[model samples]
Target: MAHLKAVQGSKAPATPPSRPLGLPGLAALALLLAGLGWLAGMVSLVQAALLLVGSGLGVVLYHAAFGFTSGWRRMIVERRGRGLRAQMLLLAVAVVLFFPPLASGTLFGHPVQGFVSPIGVSVVAGAFMFGLGMQLGGGCASGTLFTAGGGNARMVITLVFFIIGSVLATIHFDWWMSLPALAPVSLPETMGSANGIFLSLALFGVIALATLWLEKRRHGSVEASGGVLPSDRSRWLRGPWPLLLGALALALLNFATLALAGRPWGITSAFALWGAKGAAMIGFDPGSWAYWQDAGRAASLKEGIDHDVTSVMNIGIVLGAMVAASLAGRFAPNFRIPLRSVAAAVIGGLLLGYGARIAFGCNIGAYFSGIASGSLHGWVWMVFAFAGNMLGVRLRPFFFRAPYRPAVKGC
Candidate 1:
């Protein structure tokens, strides 16, 4: 009742069709899930559950066309704050939910930790570079995976180099961490929950208002987000979910992750780990690197990749998006690549990899999860990254087509 009323009151963009699930896609997804469960079950039931959660994440991300890169780009270029505003809403919800448990220090007897980190040179530089890369590479960490899984050939290129760059950065990760940085500060830890939550909400509101003002000044009116199209059924299976709903779904999912996993959601660590494993295949001993020398990390390195929580979830996200795209009849692979776009993908991907590695996360790990965990470094990340995006938007035209077109065109 409440959700329906909110939908009626709000304005979001018209969504693409919610088609029925194709039989082949459904069968494949089921088989894949079964296989993943089998693999993870070899480890533990908890691992299997995380795989399912990861799949749900991928489905929600694909069905919603949720793009962190696009969201920031739209706000910067078009002054359309709808996407960015939705992010703010997501953060608002996440913080409110996350703070209570994080402050308490334990949930269901499991020790829980937030993503608090220091504000320093490494983070500042990494985040700014990541912002630039988001435009150049065409997606953030999550965006790259989902788009690639959904059969964007160019993103496959991005994913490959993203791994290479991540591996390369491991060489200098020690130096970056050694640089001067403020102590890790959590808003909830430094300030009581009452003060932290209220202050965070106020900041969100202020940012939202500022965007509205800028949008109005630039475009003469605040743009309307056309709501999603109504459907008799099949909305979940075939989706173009409204951005707001996507935001809410993500927030709730993150909270669930915290509860289930005993930590906030993270992504890029898996990328770096995957890259390291790939290096080992060719006789490169990334295991000797300082970064992997930690007792816990070394043990994880020895275990198969699937044994790692983030790696398993990352795999789930890839497969889940593929299934979602296929179910929607939107899974069309395009191999044709322009030299200019490929150039962008290479450069952007390297930046994404290195930037994320050095910064301790990408948009998903450092920015989204960071902020939601009440880390001051998360807020610091946004400021520098946004600055990077300011310049990246300019360079984009030289490297890629001016705008994106759907695979089928008018699909």
Candidate 2:
């Protein structure tokens, strides 16, 4: 909660001025380029491109301060809907860009697919845990990467624990999968593509309108919808981008990912892979686990991190955030974390990693990509995750002595 408060309190300048780039930022940029070159040379060009795409995502996320955790928290605690509305807009735009291509089963001559997973007990329980973890951890998967890249020392701790939890979950993954689950349901497949797209858009509109009503009822007027773009060139280069712009950029980038990768964007799988690889190094046989017995999972486990798309993208996000933070002159890492906060990070990180594994993905993988892909499971994940967030907000006080104050910024 303190980390979230810090993020909310630090508003980017309205008219950002040109400033000297930090040494760290320069160094990060150099590293990013080198990473890309290595990937291009050692792996396929597509992998390298994916890294670049991930970096672009990190930049957009950091500049906009786009966050699913803070957005939901603000909506729950403060009756603010700006962040939630931006999310709705993001989903709506993604539906438009993705539906037709997914229906056709290809993008730009490449086979493509959406993130459609089963709706079941695992998703319900996992999403709920993920929601609670977001509050305690102060960030979601994407949020953790960008904030950690921006030099938040506490988040690094969360990331480490997150990896540990992910690996731990794999040990129990077989049992979770054995639980009751519905068949994967794709709206575009069940309904017609046009019909599914329309339905999804209508749902987004309804949510956005609901947020508008709630905000208006709670506070005499609703907050301004952040649809207008700033005219300043400097602001674009060093941003606090409008939430809508951030939303649009994210949607477009996701579409790019689908085109290039033949699948939707995802984040947490890399955590599991990293953990499994680490386990293997210490004489643990993750490859023998039922979760990794699958051909694809087994192959990824054996191959190095550089060959893993999610891993490369995850790294790109961190480096990209570092570059952005340095450019913004905000890459200051504070290591003086409270003991209680560290405890929260550990518990929250564990919950997040385990939850994401069981649930089939995190906010990005399950909720965002899932819903955009017209999967019924995505909707189920949202409802349960929101319920978890409600409880997580209540649990926040137990972890922190600081008085609860609403964040001023949208996610």
Candidate 3:
């Protein structure tokens, strides 16, 4: 679907085509939603709504190919800056929307809190691992979910190990918690909202300009390709959307998440819970881990996936991606795995999972939501994560002569 660039230079106006969605896929989605509803029991409406939102997330992510790892990698390795610039735009939009409500401390009567986490060793070490793991595993947290949903068989390997590593982190959470750390800090709290916004925007501008300059210097010029007249399906459903549009959608949806859940969007924590539950079912006693000592965390371990917000959202993302991929006729899953690639996936996935836990979040929770919510930890995470990516990119050649398409080349 993506390769079919609009008919270049043809004076004729082609009739826009509609992408027929796969009926079976649509049916599957319906059944999944029903399952979610049933799982929620008394809170069916709220649960269903979140599930639908999750599905929408999957669709947008899949159709747009909204990427984090790849976008950063393209800038780092290929000197392409479009994706990075788009991300800055996303942060800009998110910060503007998030800060105002978060500063006020309430939104429509629901208490709103920013994603404030401690500024310390765990974040630095974990984020560094996450960054490197993304390159090696072939996707960041969000990337892994969308790709796995879109029928990329190798990502399942990453997802499984990601869960294992996340669960393992809980066992070691006490030691990391013991590390020297500052209290959770937020720019909106320290600096006034207006001042924080100004500072954040200015930094974003600086980074955006730096990318633009670097791209021009290395590539000699930006991409020369002009937009081909888009087809109708490309506009909404079967799509390779403008990266900026993807970014904007993500920002708005994240804002919606705050409104609905009274918290920002998150991803990896669900993986940890899911893995722990699976372990508990097998009598592994993941519940005894210090991370589960918290009453809420301990209780959540006993509940089903439907009881977990992140788990439901993660399911929605996967199912949504599947529906989108199926509609786009791109839902092919090749299960055959190469030996070296398998090793990379295992190592990379473990790193991604464990790092996310240690860092207090994944790309979604820690970096994007964290920064947008004005948490200084987000900035710290990005720095170390990028360093990890630097190493991970260099190490890729050892595993595969070529990286997976869904990994870093795109989301």
**lDDT (tens digit, per residue) of candidate 1 on 1-411:** 011100111222344454555664676588667856687658887778777778778877777777677767878888878778878988999999988888889878888988888889999999998898888887888878877777677788988888888888887889899999998889888897778899999999999999899899998998665454424356576566667777788788887788778888888888788888888898999889988987877888888877888887877778787888776666656676788888988998899999988887888788888988889889989999999988999887687454642221101
| Each prediction's whole-model lDDT (CA) | 0.78, 0.85, 0.81
Model 1, clash count? 6
- TM-score for predicted model 3 compared with the true structure: 0.92
Quote model 1's TM-score. 0.91
**Clash numbers, per candidate:** 6, 0, 1
What ordering of candidates by lDDT runs from best to worst?
A: 2, 3, 1
Q: After superposition, how far is residue 23 of candidate 3 from its true place, in Å?
A: 6.2
Q: CA RMSD for every model?
A: 5.2, 2.4, 4.3
List TM-scores for all candidates, in order.
0.91, 0.95, 0.92
- Residue 36: error of model 2 in Å? 1.2
**Of the candidates numbered 2 and 3, which has the greater TM-score value?**
2
The regions of model 1 sitting more than 4 angstroms off are 1-28, 226-232, 401-411
- Cα lDDT of model 2 by residue, 19-75, tens digit: 677888888899899999999999989999999999999988888888898789888
Pick by lDDT: 2 or 3, better one: 2
Stretches > 4 Å off in candidate 2 = 1-17, 403-411
lDDT of 2 at 405: 31
> Model 1 Cα displacement at 183 (Å)?
0.9
